[model samples]
Target: MVIRHGQASFGADNYDKLSDLGHQQSAAVGQALRDMGWVPDRTITGTLTRQKETLASMGFEAGEEHAGFNEYDFQDLLSARYKGDVPDLVKGDRKVHFRTLRETVFQWQADEIENPAESWGTFTGRVESARLAACATGADRVLAVSSGGVIGQLTAASLGAPDKMMMTLNLQIKNTSITKFVFTNSAFFLHEFNATPHMMSGEAAGMLTYS
Candidate 1:
């Protein structure tokens, strides 16, 4: 199972840390997994603080750290693309920010962003490597916590979909949502994508977030 990290301090100075609702989201997903008897035999997370914190908040130990699961540097993407001056539209409002982000990311995927932290090809390659390692593990269930970018590209890779599919997948991924993959000696398939059982009820529905 792969899960997106909980909500982070989006407009705050430090965006790496989780918000109060993020903690609640993480705990809710954990509880949902527990109720369904979906205990993970192995756990992995990206090196980012938000990813690590989300897994910990879910009542799991820090099993391993993998840089391959880390997210693309969005700040750098915006800065580099805009020649180091990100416009207010890219940062001031949530809806506008994401809308601009989608366009910017499409450019990034086309190798248009100048001096980005890493190229789009590099990011996707590393994520694919991480996924292969996870599948090869001799464990029944493995839970991985990561950012939306990584999850999106990984999901696209699994489906043999085009690169642009990552944009759609990335935009829709909710915090702490679960995605399941099935891997055997002969096949690796995506069983589920962006499922949020914990936040599906009327009471928890308000907590749903895509950013």
Candidate 2:
């Protein structure tokens, strides 16, 4: 199962570490996996601090830290595409920023970028390569911590899902959400996407986010 890192601290300059709530969310994911008898034979994570910290919080020390699982820097992509100008539509208002960001991301998914730091082909290729490599290890169940974009690409490719479905799935995945995939001889089969049942009513509801 590929697990996304939990809710990150918002508005922090780093944006790579889990907030206090993030830690709780990570632990909840771990507990859920345990409930399902889904302890991974080999655990892996991207080199990002949030990924690493999420794994640690889950009480599993990841054996291999793989750069292949690392996410393309979206901040860099936005800067490159927009030439460092915050789009007028997203200026000042947090809600507007997120709304515009969602639209911008869909444009990105559709392969529309005015100026790109990395081609979409390149980004997906790297993520696919890493996923294939992890499957090659022959582990019964491998767990990886990654970001939403990478997960969305992998899930979309594996299921042959449409662009609209991909965008919707991307919009729905929350921090610390679980997305499961089954691998057979390096071929991926997606089983579940965005499963988070550990958060109790109000607490879990509070953890929900679109971005």
- Model 2: per-residue Cα lDDT over 1-211, one tens digit each: 8888887755667778888888988888888788878788898888899889999999887778777677666676666567798676555455776666667766776778766777767777888888887888768878899888778878998988875465556666888888888778846788988887776576666766544
Residue-level lDDT of model 1, residues 1-211, one tens digit each, is 9999999999888999899899889999998999999899999998999999999899988898889999999988989988998887778789988988899999999988788989998998899888887777789899999999999998898899999999899999999999998998667888999999999887898888876
> How far off is residue 73 in model 1, in Å?
0.5
Misplaced by over 4 Å in model 1 are none
Q: How good is model 2 by TM-score?
A: 0.87
- Report how far residue 6 has shifted in candidate 1, in Å: 0.6
Model 2 segments more than 4 A misplaced? 87-94, 109-111, 163-165, 200-205
Clash number for each model: 0, 0
Top lDDT: which candidate number?
1
Clashing pairs in 2: none
Question: Can you give the lDDT of residue 39 in candidate 2?
Answer: 88
